[model samples]
Target: MPSGPEVLQAIDWRQPWLAGWREWGEPVAQAVADGLPLHEALNHRSAAPVRFVPQAALPPGEAYERYIFNSGLCPTREGLHDFFNGLCWMRFPRIKTRLNQLQAAEIAAAGVAPLRGPVRDALTVFDENAAFLLAPPPLWEALMGKDWQALFVALRPLWPQARLVLFGHALLEKLVYPRKPITAHVYLAPPAIDTIANLDAWLAADLGADKLAGKPFVPLPVLGVPGWWPENENFSFYDDSLVFRPRR
Candidate 1:
């Protein structure tokens, strides 16, 4: 593999929100530096390997979690989406595995539904457009609403610790095909995070509301988050007046 420092320098992050990914995704660069393709790099042989099964090869939903437990990977095909998903597995194995277990357990219990159960819905939401938000409890509801002021202005002090790591490929892909109503998957971080950025190494301890101020948050339409447009300007996806507007 290329020198670790070289790996860090090569992978360009589009936004600061993804600084965690940039900092933590050194393996991606090391693999690249060593001339490893995406799939090989991701599913590299380990004590536990994540299998990249073709869509046709996958069994029913009920067996999915069992399959993951047995094989340490759920089904995924090759593509940019699959590629990013692999990166997520490498970055957040525990969280990803837990999500799979929940999903598989839900499927095993209720089977697939046209509308889906709350558990499945929550999992899907997290998988699709969610951001793994590491912030305080006071910021959870506000951050969920994408309240910029509550997060960054009035509660500016939180920025020293507030972090948002994305786990959704749809949100990542939207770096190109931008969209809205993109919610942050806020997961309250514990003190362990102050030292390392390993999502796999995270300990889920909700940081409840301490003495913090509330502020009216400015609703910022999240699109073109960062690194999408070349100009490096503060732009919003809602700028396309015809495509998006306030619902009246």
Candidate 2:
């Protein structure tokens, strides 16, 4: 695996999806560049609810989420995946903690069976691939209805008013090699959530066991968000039906 500094060197850090993370990520990158391991760099910078620890610190047979819930220490490894995970914990501690709490509760109720049940599955999906979109009703309506033309073209002007903050660490890591088909499981942010801090706290309080199990998300191809990718400036870009599939 590449060292933390090498992984930091590979990220552009300017991607809009990474905007929320840049402030925290830059300092962590600098520490890694100066020879700290990824987990150590993250721990040093962490004022989060949970601490960052080496992956080996997790005892065998213990579930990752359970370990964090029980110990308040997130098992972290050195790579873009874990780097983003650690950054997410720092950036959105409340949301991350809520996810771990929900996951651990499910594990306690269900045990570590092969099938992770609906609630755990939904929580895992949100943790790995969710994005929070604070957009106008038109965009939200078109997106939920899977109306590509209306969303990307007819309502293109409205995108400037929208704020799509990437909350999933795995989603952040995937954007490193961005492609057309790369999508996010989008959750519409409540109105007036103009800042990341407000969004984090609101979302953490917003999540619940019953609500998450419903799988409330709309699929949005990340690059299709206006200004996110240059190629999307052309109207024909949404013509790729595979990436922007019509609602069934």
RMSD of each predicted structure: 8.1, 1.4
Clashing residue pairs, candidate 1?
131-185
| Best of the candidates, lDDT | 2
Stretches of candidate 1 exceeding 4 Å from the true structure: 1-14, 22-38, 45-49, 59-71, 136-147, 176-183, 195-248
Candidate 2's TM-score reads 0.97
Model 1, residue 56: distance off in Å is 3.4
- Candidate 2, residue 238: how far the Cα is off, in Å: 0.4
Assess the local accuracy of residue 43 in candidate 1 as a C-alpha lDDT between 0 and 100. Answer: 61
Q: What digit string (tens of lDDT, one per residue) describes model 1 on residues 112-155?
A: 66866566666665666555545666665555565544544456
Q: For candidate 2, lDDT tens digit of each residue in 88-121?
A: 8888988998999999999999999999999999
Which pairs clash in the backbone of model 2? none
Name the lDDT value of residue 6 in candidate 1.
Answer: 34
Where in model 2 is the C-alpha error above 4 Å? 1-5
Candidate 1 residue 127 C-alpha distance from true site, Å: 2.2
